[model samples]
Target: MINRHLRVVLAEDSVVLRDGMVELLATRGCEVVATAGTAPALLAAVVEHRPNVAVVDIRMPPTHTDEGIRAAVEIRARTPEVGILVFSQHVETVWASRLLAGGAAGIGYLLKERVARTSEFMDALHRVAGGGTALDPEVVTQLMRGGRRGRVDTLTPREREVLELMAQGHSNRSIAALLVVSERAVEKHVAAVFTKFDLRASDADNRRVKAVLTYLAESGG
Candidate 1:
C-alpha cells in the first residue's frame, strides 16, 4: 500500500529495470504515474503527465550511449519544476555533469547498486523531490580525479567558490545571493573565469552549468 503518494515518471531502456523500479517505488509509497523504456517515451511522459519526479536510467535503448542524459536535459529546459534522479551502472562524470547542466537543485546521480539500500535510495528520491542534489560519492570521486593533475587548482578562491556552488546546481542569482554580491558581479566573475580558461567564447552555446563543468574539467578539478 503506497502511503507517500508521489507522482513519478520512470525511464529505463531495460524493460526489467523499468518494471523493477516501478515496483520498488510503488512499494515505497510512491505512485508510478508513468513509465518509458526509451528517451522519446520519457520525454513524452514528462510532457504529457508533468510528473513530480522523473527517475531516469543513464543508458537507454538504441545507442545506450547518452539517451537518458539528453532526455533529462530536455526535461530541465522544458519543465523546471520536475525533479530528476539519474541512475547509472557506472560513474559517467561527463553525462552526470550534463544531467546537472541546468543546475544542481532537484537533481541526483546515484549508482544503480545503491538501489539495494532501500532506505538510502528512497532518501535520494525525497531529497530530489525537495529540490536538492544527491550526487553519488563515486561520481564526485571521478570528477575529482583531475584535481591530482593540477588542472583544477588554477581557479582563484572566488572562482573556486563559484565553481563549487555551480557544481551544486545553484543559479547565478542564487550564487550571488549566497556570496552577498550583485548578480552582474557574479556574471562578471563567471565570464572572467571562463575567459581565463579559454572556454567562454568556445562554449558560448553551452548552458551555464555546462560552462562551469567544462571549466572544471579543463582545470582538472
Candidate 2:
C-alpha cells in the first residue's frame, strides 16, 4: 500500500525524468508539493513547503556536478525533520557517505534503476519519511568494499552477513527472519558488530548509522 497523503519535494535537472517521477509518485498516492530544477530551488522548496520527504538527484543544474548532494547536506543540517532520498544513474560513494554522515534516519540512497521498481521505490520513500532507512544493496556492497578489510575481515561469516543486511537498512527482526534465526541472535550479532567497530553501545542511539560510518571510514569517504 502507498501513503496517499505523503507530501514530497522533487528535484531533478532533466525535465523528462523529473516529470516521469512526479507522475509515478502521484500514481503511488504521493503529493508532489514542489519541484525544482536546481540545487538552490530544491532547497527553497524544501524550506518553504516542508514536505514529508524529498526525492533528489545526485547532480543538477549549473555545473552538472554535486549540487544535489550539497543541497542534501544543507537540508539535513537545517531541517532534519524532512526525509531525503537521493537517486543517481551512477554510484558516488563519496556523496552517499556525505548523506549518511549526520545519521541514517529519514534518509535513503538508491540507484536510478531502482526507481523503475515501483514497490521498492515507494517502500524506500515511506521508510525514509517514517524516520527509517532504505539503502540500496549496491550501495552496501560499495561500502563493504570500501571498508577496511582488516577490520571487516575480523568478523565471522555470520557477523559479516549481519553487517551487510544492516547496511541494506534491515531491522534486527527483519534480519533475523531472513537469516532464519531469532531476533535475539540478530541482537547478539549486532552487538558484536558495534563492539568490533569500536562504536559505543547505546541502544538509544542510531547505531545503524555508526556501523555504516565505520564502513565509510574504511573507504575514505
Candidate lDDT (C-alpha), each: 0.75, 0.80
Give the CA lDDT, 0 to 100, for residue 145 in model 2. 49
Task: State the local distance difference test value for candidate 1.
Answer: 0.75
**Candidate 2 lDDT by residue in tens digits, 93-161:** 666666775657688888987666688889889988988777776676675444444576678899988
TM-score of each candidate?
0.73, 0.69
User: Which 10 residues in a row give candidate 1 its minimum summed lDDT?
Assistant: 143-152
Name the lDDT value of residue 27 in candidate 1.
Answer: 88
lDDT of 1 by residue, 1-221 (tens): 12355899999877886788889888888888899989999999999999878998878889888888888888988898999988878676666666666667788888887666888778888888777767775565575443333434676888778877876677789999999999998888787666554554654335465445454445432
Q: Give the residue spans of candidate 1 off by over 4 A.
A: 1-4, 148-180, 187-221
Question: Candidate 1, clashing residue pairs?
Answer: 103-169, 104-169, 146-220, 151-219, 152-219
